[model samples]
Target chain A: MTALLKIDGLRKRFGGNEAVKNVSFEVNPGECVVLAGDNGAGKSTVIKMISGVYQPTDGKVYMNGALLTGKTPEAVRTAGIETIYQDLALADNLDPGLNLYLGREAVKHVLRFPYLDRKKMREDAAKVMLSLGIVVPDPAAPVREMSGGQRQAIAIARAIHWQAGIVIMDEPTAALGVPEQREVMALIERLKKQGVGIILISHNLPDIFAAADRIIVLARGVVAGERRPAETNDEEIVRMMMGATL
Target chain B: MTDNTVNGSNTNTKPGGTSFVRSLLNAWSWLFLILILGFFEIYAQTQTGSTLLFRIYNLQAISIAASQILLLGLGLTLVIVAGHIDLSIAFSTGFAAVVMALIIRTAGADAGWVTVILAMLAGLGAAALVGAVNGWLVAILNVPSFIGTLGTYGIARGAALIVAGGATVSIRNDHTRAFGNGDILGLPVPLVVAAVLTLICHYLLKHTRFGAHTYALGANRASVERAGVNVKKHLILLFILSAFTAGIGGLIYTSRFSAGAANAGEPILLYAVAAVFIGGASLTGGQGTITGTVIGAFIIAVIQFGLVFCGLPPYWQFVAVGLVIIVAVLVDQSKDRLMGGKS
Candidate 1:
């Protein structure tokens, strides 16, 4: 199948420092492309380029064969790309339902003013929470009152809420414990089954082995190699990540 | 592990040790207000030796003074909640009040209530415009709100002075009399207006998306930006709201005092800030409530009146009130620390 996202010769330079050097990869639909690398291996830079958080110095990014390139995160979102950052990018003071539908809130056709159709939004939020198995005791409780795993689930739900074609998660499981990561892995499996292309940035080896169809290793701002978990082992992948071998 | 491992929540907050304490802490300011009221009541009876706790005229006095603080505090709460402050809000009121008085005075006796209405609208419009200017400066130009509003304060007050030619515009027509002295259901019209305004503000902040966004923006502007909401637009809107309410206070003040001087709004600004701070609004933003602002305003008004009734000098009022603000802030810090520890 044709790749859902294709990044060709992506390069990013900040001042004299080159963060990402002509890294190229293709993420096929219904595939989890695990981006594995050490610190400063340009994993985040590449993700940022794809999500339009940073403008690539030189490259072309194609989503479903359509050229999408730039520093506008909103444009990336409009083009069906959603990013869930490590911070979760959620309003802590706002309720879960409001955070889920923020920026694109559901408003009634009352026409008086942009009054939020809160009832409808709440109902919809409940549906999404249920689908994700996020058993929030009170959806209206502010996110600051939620636990870490629930917040992560909420962020993931928000990213997939509008059926985005590609979901880029930046260290989603970084703050999660073993069981929480397992819970999130199930959600990822569900999304992969739905044919959503996912780029997961994680240091967890077992998770990558379990979920990633193709592991793309970056070393010194270049793609060291791509390997399948069935054929390769963590020791080999760690070497590639450490720039010891490809 | 418990389900509390998901996000920032803890098991302690769910249904454990002391929910009564948590709820009380959640609405701590209300309790604080009642405490202050009770304290003053006891002081009044024992020291002043009179039944002046809820006297009709005493309540009116409290309402009149606290009402203005309540209105100003309402707007400031929004601004502060959104992680911004408008120092020019006081001047926005002064400028609008001066414009209003100028319009009414220029229109003369033949103009009547129509002129009064026109003046009020003009004042509000002018204040809103100034507020928008403050918003643009802070939101669009990326100027720090403190500096932006500082500049506006000087400019607005200067403009008001220049417009009124450093003179007080006195209201001679009976059109404004009703607004100044009229009572609704045994409450002064201004007090009633303040109460209604508080309700509207409560609805806007609690029930509307705009209110949610305001708190979100204050808590984390980056999160709001990533959500694709225009952070600048919300910040600007908040300043505009602050200006609009300040103008309301100014117009009412013009009627109550029967004069609109360029410096009319000067004294109320600091007091309003005190009220918001007293109401449990965090200085860094993202936590303020309408109920807190209302109660905080009353606490401030009561302190101001309580001192005078105790035969304290006028200057002693500030000293006593200042202590209350300090104590309120200390209370806020402790509450924050307690909440933080729980998380």
Candidate 2:
């Protein structure tokens, strides 16, 4: 499979501390790649760089074989890169459809007014939710009134709706209950089936073993190794994450 | 864990009808302000009867005053909703009012109509420029809004004083005076203008993408930035809108008094901010309604009217307004608790 995104020698520094150092990875189309790491292992820093939230101190990011650097978050999003932070970054006050269409709202052309195309947004939101097989009581219901699982699904739906070629989810299921977590993991698999690339950041080993096609372990701001889940067990993945002799 | 369990039990389970009623009680702070205002209105009516209400009533006077504040509050609400405050509005209003007045005076009597129009534009323009400075200082220069707007407050006030030379500039023209005293179908001209603008603001804030973005920005600016809305741009626009209203408020004041005072608008800032808070706008930003603010302004107006109607001592009026402000703030705090304490 062709690599949809390529990062080469990525380095990031915050004052004296180096968060991501000499890290490189490639994500192909339609693959769910998981990055497993212990705390403070620079998982977030790497993700931030990819989503254009932070500038890399030194490195290169290629999206669809074209170089991407110094792009704003809005620019990055326009270029089809969407990120779902662990917080879901979903506005709680806005309803699901509004959240889905936020920033990128559709407007009527009569006077170039900024009215939201509620019917279209609702229809599209319903289609996205239905495609993920996630049921929402009301598309107009605010996310603040939603469960952790449903919010996760809504965030995923938003990224996908934006036509993001690569979806980066930070700890997609860490705080979710078993059923909610399972629902999210299932959605990841669904994304892969639809031929979209996914970069999932997580600490949950079983989920890594079950959902990821390829697992990359990061430790101390470096890429420890990458292995196909079928080729390596969770114990070895854990060893790679902690740099331990296991 | 208990809270989670309680929340969990509510998962897919809305509380019973009783909780719905209970939620209304929990949301009492907003409603209570209205009730208190209503009570005062009733008391005023009872004491003075419809006779005083009819005799002393100048629907146009209230409309003109409220409309000016309405415009100012519209912008102030935007800034305040974004978890910030601007105190320079008084100065912004005075400065714009004087600048326009001077220009109109220079242009001659027929220039009075042109002056009023130009003055409004000048006021809006001045406020917007001041607002832009406020936004840049706060967003780019990283100054706290309180400090930034306060500084601009001093500058704008100084400019107003210098322009008028500490003297009242009478806008003495029948055409301009008509705005202050004229009526349309038993309504003040200023009120009609205010009503029109209020409707426009209501639509923009509630129905437009920019308005939604404003709410998102006010609720959590960082998140809104992350969501890719230009936080600085929005902040600038918010301040501009507020100052613009202040400019109009100054215009209305000048029209009513038929002269501009360098210090004429200082008292209005407190009343405007108070009315906003009393109307259910959170000072923390990200929560409020234009409708609520209009009602709040009415409430204040009613109180003032009520006191004078009852022949209450003028000193008591100050005490009453102060109490209303304190009670309104306390009510706002309690409402936050009921809204899940997020704001």
Candidate 3:
């Protein structure tokens, strides 16, 4: 199958330091590719380049055979690549409906003047959340009032509602509880079932082993190795994460 | 991890009693306004042998005072809601007023409606220029809004003074004066303008996509940017909107008083800021409403007018307003805590 996303020899240099060097990967549709690494192993830099937060010094990213390198973060999102940062990046002061459509709000016309179509947005948000199996008791309440899992669900729902072809989650379950973590893992399974491509960045080995179809370990600024979960154990992956020879 | 029970247990854990208290706390500012009005009405009846609330003249005076502060506070409310400040508005108002008055003075006091309209646009443009500078300094240059606006405040104040040649530029336009002071459908023209502007701003802040992004911008700017928003452009527009409203204040100042001093908006700046805070906007941003700001403006106006009507010295108005602002903030903090702590 054609790759849903392809990172062609991605390389990033910050001043004299090479952050991500000669890293390449491809994510096929319906695949969960987890990027695992120790802190400062250039996992973030690689994703940042792919998400358009940072322009690659020498590399290219493609979404469905279209060049995505050098695009602005907003442009990247419009091109169907959604990145859910570790913080969830939610406006805590707004309701789920508003948060779901933060920059691109739904508008209706009254007397030829455009106004927020809040009812439509709210109903749509409700439908999306319900489909995600996330029950928000008060749709009008700000997301800040929600539990951690609910907020995570909202972030995921936002991406899904936008019909994002590729979703990059950075430590999505890091701040969640055990149950919430399970919920998030379940969400990953659902997304995979929907044929959406996912690039998950994580530190938790159990989470990586559980959610990843293929684990790509990063050591320093380069790809250490890649393995199918069925073919590798935590011990070997940990060695690869430590810059061991594949 | 059944999907059916996801977050359902914790969601219902918020007791109804606490939520009731939270709602009441949210309306604390309104309650405070009514309480002050009641106190003033009682004082007018018992001390002055007159009814305060029942008198149209007193109501008109109070509302007119509120209308002035509200004009300045309206756009500032959005700025504050978006987690920024525009201190230069004090002088932006003065600058616009002086520029308008200068144009009118040069065009001749009886320079007809066309000249007056052009002058108003020029005035608004001057204020918007100040706002753009503020946006550039804060948004693009990454200057903290407080410091950036404060710098613009000094620059605008000096510019207004220099433009006015260091004195109030007074004019005598019969049409301008009538528009400033005349009644529209039984409402004072200034009050009418303020009311109409208030409705428009309320709509902009409450019912538009721009407003939604504004709230999101304040709450989490990264969220807005990641969601494909041009945050810099939005910031620039927000500052311009702020200056635009303050410019309207300046235009009214020139027309209503027949003079546009460099310090025209200086005295009202404090009241405008107070109204915003009293309206429940936090310094940290991401919380507030236009309705709350309107009520806040009225609260300040009523206290200022009521104190004088009850024979208190004018300086007492300052002290009283200061005390009320403190109380409002304290109430706001308590409300946040009541709502299970700040988010």
Candidate 4:
């Protein structure tokens, strides 16, 4: 089957240095593709380009073969792609329900002006959290009050709830503990069963093997190697990451 | 679940969760507000030899004063929540007052209430224009909101002065005067307007997508932008809302006074900022509430009026307001730390 999301020869140049140079990748439906690289391997740059966080010097991102022409992040979202950065960006002052529906709020007609359908939005927020099995201390509490793992779950749930066709996770479990990491892994498994394409970037080898069906290694803004988890071991992947011959 | 340090306190003390007392302690702002009202009410009871603050008689007078500053505080809350501060709100309101007065003066006679409505629209339009410039300067040109709106303060003050020709424009129109100083049933028109506006704003801030985005923009601009929301457009709209609301407040103010002058809004501008800050709105942005602002505004009005009831000089009233602002801010910080930066 053709890839649900395709990044064609993605190139990004910041001044004189090419952060991401001629990188190409594809993620088929329900497949998890890992970008394994050391620091400065252009993994972040490539991910940002695909997510429309950065304007590619030269590249084209496609969702199911349809060109996502607009450079704005909203445009990329409209094309059915969502990204979860390492920061797990959430508005700390707002409640869980408010943060979940930040830009897309439920509204009911009131005479002429459209008033917020707060009841509906709050109900939906609770529903989505339950559906994803994300347990938090209080959904009504501010996000700043949440732990790292809970925040991560909320971020992932936000992207998925948007019905995104492709989900890009940048080190989804980097700062999380073992249990939290396991929770994120279970979430990834659930997404895979739902037939959603995933592009995961990580330096954690175990996480890579656990979630990824295929791994693409990049060094110095270029693809170095590609392998299946069954076909390669951690030692080989480490050598590839260090620019040593496989 | 194993970490005691995670919540600083046990989050799951009971299946029903933390007791009502614990919940109240966490909401320190409300506690502070109730204490303020209680102290003032007691003071009034002793001074006047009767319990009278909550009575409909005193509420009319307090609300009139509260309503004037309430609009200003509400605007600042929105601007601050969206990561912007509008220093020019007071002068913008003055400019709007002048705009309304000018329309009334020109309408002469035979224009009826139609002229009053037209003037209100024109005032609003001028206010929106002022807001647009602030938005453009800050959002598009990258000028800091503090500096951008500071410049507007001078512009609006000057524009008001120029339009009024350095003299107070007496509003001859009965309808225009009624809008400011008249009554709706038993309540003052200004008080009723304030009540309606406060309800609408409370709903908007709590329930709307725009309000949610405003909170996000203040918290983390990059995050919201990446989430596919239009950051620039949202910021611009927020500033516009701030200025536009200030302008409406100005119109009502001019109507009540039966005249519009450049210096009319001068006295209340600083108090407006103080009201929002006292309401627990952060100067750095990311958090605020309309309900808090309403109460904050009433606190100011009560203090200002209470001083008079105590037979204190005007300077004492000024000192009291300043002190209350400082104390309220201190409470705001203490509350935040108590809640472990939940604010």
Chain A TM-score values, per prediction: 0.93, 0.93, 0.96, 0.91
Residue ranges of candidate 1 with Cα displaced over 4 Å: A8-23, A54-60, A65-72, A108-123, A175-190, A193-195, A203-207, A242-246, B1-15, B42-50, B109-111, B184-186, B341-343
Model 3 docking tier (incorrect/acceptable/medium/high): medium
Local error of candidate 4 at residue B152 (angstroms)? 0.9
- List-wise, what DockQ does each model earn? 0.43, 0.30, 0.59, 0.36
State each candidate's clash count.
Answer: 9, 2, 0, 1
TM-score of every candidate: 0.88, 0.86, 0.95, 0.87
C-alpha RMSD values across all candidates: 3.5, 4.3, 2.2, 3.9
Cα RMSD, model 4? 3.9
The value of fnat for model 2 is 0.25
Q: By the TM-score metric, which is better: model 2 or model 4?
A: 4
lDDT of 2 at B215: 72
lDDT of 1 by residue, B1-343 (tens): 1433233333425545555666776677677767767887888899878745779888789878999887677888899888888889888889888889889888885668878999999999988988999999999999998899999999999999999898888867677867778888987989998989898888788767788788888888878888777888888888999999898988988888778877777888888988888887878888888888888898888878877777778788788678878987877777665554222
The worst-scoring run of ten residues by lDDT in candidate 2 chain A lies at A107-116
**lDDT (0 to 1) per candidate:** 0.82, 0.76, 0.90, 0.79
Instruction: Give the per-residue lDDT of model 2 (tens digit) for A106-189.
Output: 666447656767667767886786676666666775666667777787888987887889999888887878877777877888
lDDT (Cα, tens digit) per residue for candidate 2, span B55-130: 4364444555567667667778767767788888878888777776776666677764666787768766876777
Please list the residue runs of candidate 2 whose C-alpha ends up more than 4 Å from where it truly belongs after superposition: A8-22, A39-42, A53-72, A109-114, A174-183, A204-207, A244-246, B1-13, B22-61, B105-112, B322-343
Per-residue lDDT of A74-149 in model 1, one digit per residue for the tens? Answer: 8889889999888888878777778888878777655475577777777777677666666667767677776666
Query: A85-118, model 3: which lDDT tens digit per residue?
Result: 8899899988899888887889999999999998
Clashing pairs in 4: B180-B256
Considering DockQ, which of the candidate structures 2 and 3 is the better prediction for this target?
Answer: 3
